[model samples]
Target: MGKRVLITGSNRGIGKKLVEQFAQNGFNIVACARKKDDSFDDYLKDIVRMYNIDVTTSYFDMEDEQCIKRELKSVINKVKTVDVLINNAGYGQNALFPMISSNELKKEMQINYISPIIISQIVSRVMIRNGGGSIINIASVSGIRNEQGRLAYGSSKAALIFATKTMSLELAPNNVRVNSVSPGFIDTDMWNNRSEQIYKKVLSETPLGRQGNTKDVADLVYYLASDAASYITGQNIVVDGGRMI
Candidate 1:
């Protein structure tokens, strides 16, 4: 398809995999990151050359609310309009409830919850003007689970999931779909940093008996962005191998 996708956190594991997946499927890409990475940028460049796809890489700090809007405006200026938007840029938190500081909690909410909403507000307007689009939020399993730790990060993602529902309802009339994907124990750099005991517990709980991969999440997003999933909206589709159950 010739449609374009705007994916934040493009330098990270899942984000990078999502870029290539959409590119291979012939979707023009707009890759957004908090900062510039030479190696990652070079990788995106190679993707453009090999896939013969249009790719735009943008750099801006998600912590800055104004910058979030400004950068997305810049993207719209260049791409004209984005058909799909993925808010995948988020920092994980491992602090227990009492251990989490107010500053840390606010930071997590700003980057993970507030920032995605701000970006969605901008892009949803564009989508409405351009006849509609899809918005996929990459949330986490901790958001819905009553797990130890994850006080800051889990609350932030919980806010995102709620927004996904509200947005889907409001934007449905405009044909803009909004949904979230919550992945559990996904094997990425983020997971690499987890304590061995934590990893073992999650693996044991996962019905699939294995950690998830980026493709598992990407495939669901791609479908939601496609016509096949035209009737789906306001759904938080978990991709954690029944871990939530």
Candidate 2:
């Protein structure tokens, strides 16, 4: 049996890519995503066949705290000890402050901030008992920079990043490392939906002159979860192609 990793939002985009990279690297994966029907099941089957690695799936609604707890409990029961946890399940709704609703704000906070913290708390207990583990929170460049339509989305990510720093301090003594990765303009479903003008502006500002691919983020995450980053913790590493500069 290989080391185990639990990744949330593993059915698509960056999460899906993370699963592939980790599976290729010989990690047994406990992939979590919303139950979207038979297609997701087929995809999981393909992933297991392609990587020849142990793969399991759990369905959960991040907006529902009870569902998150129940689903995570199921994973914990099956894996017993998870070596890595990647909090990659999140969505951004583009709306200016005036257009944003209270419901939207709450949902964003729940999914992007509160849910990850809860998942981390539960997984950290197992990690502590097992002597150590890594927790990586997928933050965003929008969290670091103020954007017009990211009132709720950006605030939620910023909170997650802060939570990562706090978790790192408390979990370090237990050998549980906590860190965050803030990606710039990644060409995922999230970016694909943006307007052409938004895309053009982002590319023009990005030193790389292009959006990053899923593998770009996945590779950095793999490194953080490996023994190579043993001494690293509580840091938010940005992978934005120098866009912040």
TM-score, structure 1 vs. true = 0.97
lDDT against the true structure, each candidate: 0.90, 0.93
Instruction: Write the residue-wise lDDT of candidate 2 on 1-245 in tens digits.
Output: 78999999998899999999999999999999877668877877887898888888889999888988988888789879899999999988999888899999999999999999999999999999999999999999889999999999999999999999999999999999999999989979999888999899999999988789999999999999999999999999999888998
RMSD of each: 1.1, 0.9
Off by over 4 Å in 1: none
Write model 1 residue lDDT over 136-164, tens digit each, in one string. Answer: 99998878987788888999999999999
Query: Stretches of candidate 2 above 4 Å error?
Result: none
TM-score quality measure for candidate 2 = 0.98
